[model samples]
Every structure is written in structure tokens, then in C-alpha cells.
Target: MQFVNSKAFAQGLDETDPLRSFRSQFFFPKVRPDAEYLYLCGNSLGLQPRSTRTMINEELDDWAKYGVEGHVEAKRPWIAYHENLTKMMAKIVGAKPHEVVCMNSLTVNLHLMMVSFYRPEGKRRQILIEAGAFPSDQYAVASQVRFHGFDPNTDILELAPREGEDTLRTEDILSYINEHGEKVALIMLGGVNYLSGQAYDMVAITKKGHEKGCTVGFDLAHAAGNITLELHDWNVDFAVWCTYKYLNSGPGGVAAAFVHERNLDKDLPRFEGWWGHNKERRFKMEAEFDPIPFSVEAWQLSTPPIFLLASLRASLKLFDQAGMKSIRAKSKTLTSYLEFLVEDTFGSRDWIITPRAPSERGAQLSFRIPKDGHGVLEALRNRGVICDFREPNIIRAAPAPLYNSYPPVPA
Candidate 1:
């Protein structure tokens, strides 16, 4: 592909982008009335949609007008509210409607899924995970091992990148799986490494895990709205993700869980709540727990926060309109442009730690500074370029294709 200078290229790409106009739909943070910060942090928290306020207001109006009767009398009807979110989410993740549900937070759902699928038996008691998995996931896996009467230190097998390497190679990951697969009961990994922005090959990993009679799951916190996924087609056993990041739900918005249709009726016990009970018989308050017979619905533990669900409903609609394919295309071009700018700015002196191949990453770029990295990040922030700082020496910048513009990449 022929490249253009940063400014011209950004303008040209945005002009040609079919979804470029969607940027006006969001509420960009403006520290100065005349200026907007370059927001490249959607991998951490997405820019809020302008429609979020109106959607949330509608729910508030219903709550005030109908009070408790809002359960059924509200315009969207709180009683059947979560159902409204299913189809869009299913489409985004490439799963059947019955296989996806918006439910508890990411960590909570991970534990619940573990309760059902991480059945430790005989010598097959280990949980295989990436060495630098997200802290929450690491804690969850460790706790599960301890809960099951196993030593976590020994039971949790984390595969680290080879010495002096920055990213994990697919061959290395597969080799670890092949070596430890027979002993592993579960393989839970982040769909995209949060700090490095490396997108794992989920299809190959899932296939290999199943071949060894192990369940496979993903923590798609950074990957959910940033990339294209085919969880069902990949035959992934289960997956969980939070919406606050790329999904653009508000902070701590309810997360989602996915289960392949094949495992919906396997009789594997889960830690359930009344929401997981069959809807028709739930109000009867029966003594026995009879789950709703769907992979995703069966994972719900309580009534989801209606206000948060309202925000997600608005965001998911935006996603459906733009579609993941188009979003990813813009993401690749925009991020590649930013990477080009960064390299051009520092020439051979600065390092871009994120994968150079667009196929291997999402929209985020993790740039490393050999000197005064934190100070440089602060300087960028002072210049009205908003990104994040990781410990040691990396600034993680994500140009959300939906909201970021070209001027900010070099500014």
C-alpha cells in the first residue's frame, strides 16, 4: 500500500471512510472548549456515545413515572429488558442468540464459568494460561485451584514468552499446549494481550485444547468491540468480556458471557442466581433450581442494572450499524497511520512495541521510551493527547476508529 504523510493520509482516509460520520455521535472529552484531546484509549475506556444520555434519561423517566410497575409498564419494559440486547451482542461475537448473555462483571462471570467447566479430576487438574495474563484472571484461576483442594502454585501453568522476547509466538503457545495439554483441565487466555496488544489465534488454541479433552475460554476485555471474532465457529467452549472498554458502556457496565450451544445442556453445575432460573417458573420460587436451557442465559445470576443495560443497548446499536468488519478496517488504517507518525517523529531512536503486522493486533499501540517514558507520556497528555502509562516504560495509545481523528495522531 502506498503511504501518505500523516496529516494528508488521515484526512484522505477519514474522507473515504463510510463510518467516519459516526464520530459525531459520541461525546468526546474536551478539556478546553476549543480543543479536544486525541483519545487513543478506547482499549481502556471507550468514548461515551452522545445517545447514551438520552437512553439513560428514558429509563429514568420510566422509573419515575411507573415506579415499581416499570418492571412491565416502562417503555422498554424492565422485565424483558436483557432480551433486547441479545441479538446485537450475538452478531458481534458470531454466536447464536441463545449462546450469548449480558450478565455479571468479567471476573465474576469467569469464576462462575470455572465452577461449571474447570472440573479437576485425576491428573488433569492444571489450568494453562499466558504468563502475563491480566491480574484479575490470574487471581481468579489461582482462587479456583485453591477452592478445588489443589495447590495453585503447582496447578496453574503459565506459559511465558521465550527469553528476551516481547511477544508470545503462536508456535510457542501451541508447544506449551501440546506439552501440558494432557494435564490441563482448562485454558483461559486473554483474546488480546492488554499491554502488548497481541491478538491470539483463538481458533487454533481452542481446537488444540479440545483435542486434549480440555475446555477453552477467553477474556475478551480488549478484543470484544475492537476486532472480529467467531466464537461459535471457532468452537470455543466459553468466553467472557466487560463492556466498559471498546464496547462503550459506562464504567463498570455489566459484562457478557458466551457458551457454545453444545455445552448448554451438559448438566455441568454452575453457581446460579434467580435470573438463571427458568423465566416462566422463576416467580413461582420453586425449591429446586431449574436453569433456562440456553448457554448464555443460564449464566445470569441476578437482574442486570437496567440503567447500565440502557447505555449498552445504545452502544450496541451503533456497533450493529457500523459493523465489526468496517470498524476493524478503519482501525487497521488509523492505527497504522499513528504508528507511522510515531516512527517518523523519533526516527530510529524511539521504539513502537506493539506488533507491526496489522493482522496481529487491534487499534492500540504500546510505545516504549528508553528514557523518561513517564515524563514523555505526561508531556503528551499536557499537549492534549490522552493515552495511558504502564509501569516500567510504555505508553498505550488506542485510536478508536469510531471517535479518533488524524490530527491527534501527530499532535
Candidate 2:
């Protein structure tokens, strides 16, 4: 679809958007008494769903009335609450219900998946990762290597772009994997990079890593719900993500993980907790660790925080209603329109580091700022454009399919 740069054209698109009514379901930040903020920060933290309070209050009321009995007596039983979420969560990630479980936050789950999947030994101890990975992921991989008695400097392969480029090229990645794949124990990447907003070709990458005899996985913090995924069909080894962004869970909300069914009950080492033990035999307080067969719940280490799960459930319900296909349909259009607007306004004066092709990105358009653009974000903030500035010189704007429309032109 050809995109126009005029506000009238943008409003026309908004008026006909299939997902337009979804904008009313979220609570946007109010930057002033005069008007609402044009929240373009879903890549960071999504606008809160207005139903969050009612959902939380249901849990509160259950706790207030049922006391300890709420564990079994709440409208949604606490013992089985996480189970209630698996089907929808799996659909969002394109996995089987048993392969996915909503659990710990992103970094924590990454470490957990590494425990089972990143079994480096002999000549294959190195982890292949992006150079500018989210810092927590870098730290997580470093510590995992150190924990296994390897020098992180030697064990972590930080893949970088061609000189003066901002994003990794697919050909470069495949070529690197072909050359050094045998020595690498794992290939972990953010499915959609947080900074450049480039969505990797997971299917091709996963196949390449596996052919090279490496465990292939992704951190879906920015990918889950933002794009279509097929962890099961892609034969992806594992993945982890935080739900606060595109999933629209609250701040620091519960995250989730996906493990291929082929790996379940394979005698892998995992950090065990009572919750991971077989539910039928759990109450007996058996000393033996009997895991839930064929389920990713085997990796869970503790009782889930039901409040966080409930918040995510609220968002998942919306996802269930909107279907991922519809979500992706609107997302491509919204992000393409966003890219067109940014380029029309700034032209070549500012750089758009994100991939221009809609197929290679999600809902975000990241613009590299000029040296004098330091105060630009602040001005946008004051004018009610809610975007985020990354260190050095990047301004990230995400027109979330759920709650964002095209920004009105600057006067």
C-alpha cells in the first residue's frame, strides 16, 4: 500500500482501521490538562488496559473473602491459575499449549532456559549473540559462561554489523553461523531487536544454527505479540519474553517461556521447585522430584505470582478476541505509516535506523537523532508525543496496533 504523509490521509486510515476501537481499551498517559498523550512507547511499556483494576480487584476480593481458602476457592483457583493461561499464551507465541508457560521475568527465564539448553562442553562452549544485546542478556550470557568455568571473553561471540551499519544483515548472520557454528553451543538473539527494531528470520536462523549443531533460541521481549511467531514449527529450542511491552501487562509484570516438546523429559538439568513437581503428588511432600511430563511447567521453580498472571490474562483475553492475524495486519500498516511520516518530516536530515521494509520490522520506527536533536524528545513530550530516547542518539516511536494512531504533524 502506498502511504501518504498528510494528516488528513492519516486520519482517514485511522477512521477505517479494523483495530481502531482497541485504542479506547487502554489508558494513555495524560501529559497535560488540555489533552491526551500520543503514546508511541509500546516498545518500551505498553499503555495499561483500563480493565486492569477490575481484574486485580477480583483477585483482591477473593483473597479478602476466602482467606487461605482462596487458593482453592477463588473464582480462578490459584493452584491452577497458570494453567488457565497456557493456551492463549501459546497461541500468541505460536506454540503448543504444553510447550509454553507464563512464569518469571525475561532475564530470569533466559537464565533458566540456558541452564537446560546451553550445555557447552569441549570445543563448543561459545555463545553466539548480537553485539548490542540488551545489557541484561549480555550479562546473563557472560555469567552463564563464567558459571561453567569458561572465560567470557573467549566464550561469547558478539556478532556485529558491517562497518558503519546499524543492523545485522541476514546474509551476514547465516554466513557467520556456517563458519563458526560447530564451536558455538547456542545462538541466542532478540527476535526483534530492541534498538534497531529489525525482526530476524527465525525460521532460517534456527535451521542454520541446528545444521551447525548449535542450540538455537531467541529472547522475545520485543517480539512476542508484536509479530507472528511459530516457535513450534520453527523448531526453536526455547524462548523468553517480558509481557509489559506489546502484551500490555502492567509494569514489571509476569513473563513467559517456550520449550520445544521434543526436549521435555529428556533428563536435562533444571532448577527444580515444589511447583514444578507433579501436581498430583505435590501435596504428599515427596522428597523425590517428579516433574510434570510433556509440559514446560517442569521448568518452573516456584508458585507463580497470581496477580501478575491475572494482569497478563486480561491482556491475553484481548489478544484472543483480536486474533494475531488481525493484529499483524494492522501492525504492518501502522508501522509503515509511522515510517512514512518520520521520513516525510525529517527527510535525510535524520536517519531511520529501522529497516524500511515492513516485512523486516514490527510496529516500531527508530530514528537516529541529529547532534542538535537532544532537546527534541523533550519538546515532543511537552507537545504530547510519548516516545523514548535511547542513549547516544536514537528516538524510538512505536505506534502500537492496540492503542496508537498516526501522530498529528508539528505546527
Candidate 3:
């Protein structure tokens, strides 16, 4: 697709876009009294859906009317609230309904997942992870290794990119797994690197790790709604993601997790709680923990957070209406157009560190700043381009397919 740096081209893309109506469904920040911000920060925090307020109000009203009884009497019924989101949420992450569950936050879920999957044993107690794995993941894996009486320095292998590259190559990752796979207890990675916006091949990595007798998992915070995932088919041992970023579930919203059907019945070590016990016997106050049948729900820690779940449902319904296939189609075009415009505008002044191949990235394009780049972020903000900037020197702009738009230029 040949892209031109003209408003006409941008307008043409928007005019033909089937998901165009979704932009109006979200609330954008104001650049001026009459203009809207160019909000490309969905990779950080998504813009709130217009329907979110109404959704929350529904739960509020139920609580007001039924009080404690609302647990069973609310319009949606609070007792089994997480059930409403099960199927739709499962579809978004590409998992069987039983394999997916919405519970806890991202880091908390990561900790819980590690409890069950990261079983370190005699020579093979090492954990293999990306060099610049998100700080939380690094901390979680390191601490887990330490908890199991292993020294992180010797037991945790950080796979770095080759000599001069900014991101890890698939070959490098696979090669490492082939060489030291036996010693590795777990292979963990952020499905999409938050900094580089590089999307890893989860399927290939999971296959190789299992063959090497290592458990595999992913932190899909940036990848969940931004990319197409087939976690169940890919045979990912487990995966977790937050809804706030690409899922458009407001700030610090509830998170989702996936546990493959194959691993469901295994007597894995997990931190258990009553919520994970069998639903039929939940009220019986059973001292023994009988986990919900063959599903990730067995890992649940507490009762669902209904208000946040309502906000997430509002977003997931939109996802259901506009399927992932269609969303992905527009994302590719939008990012490509933004890439063309960035190159055309900035020329050789700034560098785009994200991979040129669409398959290797999502909707985000990160630019490497030459010097004091913080000012560029303020300038972009002042001009209404709501993108995100990082500490070292990178600005990430994600043109979310659900709401981002290239407005028509004035005559």
C-alpha cells in the first residue's frame, strides 16, 4: 500500500474504514475548545469508552436497590458476576472458555501463575527471560527463583539482543532455548515488549520450551487486544494480561489469565483460596479446597470486583461487536500510515526503533530521541498528540484501531 503524506489519503482511509464509528464511542482529550487530541497512548492507558459510565451506574443502582441481596438479585447478579465476561473475554485472547478467567491484577496474577508453573528442580532450576523483560516480570521471576532457594545471578538467564540490535531476534531466543533449555525451569516473556513494541511469536516459543521440558508463560499486557492471540492452540502453559491498556477498561482495570486445558488437572502447587473451591459447595464452608472443574478458575484468589468488571464488560462488548480480525486489519493500515507520515515529517532527525515488519509489531511505533526528548513529548502534548515517552529516550505512539483517527485537513 503506497501511502502519501496528504490529508486526502488519511481521509480516504477513514472514509472506507468499517470500524470508523468506534471513534465516536470513546471520549478524547481536548486539544483546544474545538479540537480533539491525537490520542495514540492506548499502549499505556486506553481512552474510556462512552458507555462505561452507564455500565457502572447499572451496578450502582443494583447495590442501592437490593443492598446485600444484590449478590443474587441484581440485574446481572453479583454472586456469579465474572460469568458474564467469560465467553467474550475468552474469545479476545483466543482460548477455550474454561481455559480463561478474569481475576486479580497483572502483577498479582503473574505471581500466582509462577507459584504453579515455576517449579525449580535439581540442575534445571534456571529461568530464561528476555534481557529487557518489563521490570515487573524481571522482579517477579528473580524473586521466585530466590524463594525456591536458588541464586538469581546463576539461575536467571537474560537473553539479550545481538551486538547492535535494539530487539531480540527469534533465532537468538530459539538458539538459547536449544542450548540451555534443559537447565531452564520456566521461559517467560512479555508477549509484546512495552518499550520496543515487538510482538513475540508465542506459539513457536511455547512449542520449543515444552519440548525442552520447560514451562512457558507470557505477560500479554501490551499484546492482548492489540494483536491476534491463539493461546490455547499455541499450547501456552499459561498467560496473563491487564485490561487497562488495549482492552479499554479504564485505569488499572481487572486482568485476565489463561491456563491450558492440559495443565488444568495437574496437581500443581498454587496458593489456594476459598473462591477457587467448587461453586456448588462454596457456601457449605468446606475446609478442603475442591477447585472448580478443569479451568483456570482454580487459581482465583477472591470474589470478583464487580464495578471494574462492569467497565471491562463494556469494552469487551465493543470488541465482540467489532471482531479481532477486523480490528487487526485496520491496525496494520493505521500504523503503516503513521510510519509513513513520521518518516516523511521527521526525515533523518529521529529513528523508529520498532520493527519494519508488521508481523513483528503491533499498532505502536517508538521513536528514539536524539537529546532532551522530554520537550518533544510536552510539545506533542501541547499540540494535542497524546503519546507516551519513556525514561531513557523513546516516544511510543499507538494508533488504536478502536478510536484513533487521522482527521481531515482544512482547505
lDDT of 3 by residue, 1-411 (tens): 888889787888889999999988998887677888888899999999999999999999999999999999999999799999999989888999999999999999999999999998889999888888889899998899989998999999998888988888998889889999999999999999999999998888998999999999999999999999999889999999999999999888999899999999999999998889899999999788889989899899898999999999999999999999999989998898889887888785238889988999999998898887899998888777888898699999899999987653211
Worst 10 residues of 2 by lDDT: 402-411
Look at candidate 3 and give me any clashing residue pairs. Answer: none
Clashes of each: 1, 0, 0
TM-score of 2: 0.97
Assess the local accuracy of residue 309 in candidate 1 as a C-alpha lDDT between 0 and 100. Answer: 94
Off by over 4 Å in 2: 407-411
**Global Cα lDDT for candidate 1:** 0.88
Q: Give the alpha carbon lDDT tens digit for every residue of 1-411 in model 1.
A: 566665677677778888878989998777687667778788889989999999999999999999999999999999889999999999888899999999889999999999988999999999999987889999999999999999998999988887977788998888889888999999999999998888899988998888888999999999999888999999999999999999999999989999999999788878888888898898998989888875568778888799999999989999999999998998898888878776677674236767789988999998777788889888988888888988778789898888876654333
Q: Where does candidate 2 clash, by residue pair? A: none
Among the numbered candidates, top TM-score falls to 3
Each model's Cα RMSD: 1.4, 1.4, 1.5
lDDT of 2 by residue, 1-411 (tens): 888877788889888888888878988677666568888889999878888888888999999999989999999989999988899999999999999999989999999999999999889999999989999999999999999999999999988999999999999999999999999999999999999899999999999999999999899999999999989999999999999999999899999999999998689989989889998998999999999888999888898898999899888888888889999999998888776766677675248899888889999888888774569998988777878988778899888898776646332
Per lDDT, the best of the predicted structures is: 3
Go through the candidates in order and give each one's C-alpha lDDT.
0.88, 0.90, 0.90
- Segments of candidate 3 deviating more than 4 angstroms: 348-350, 408-411
Clashing pairs in 1: 40-398
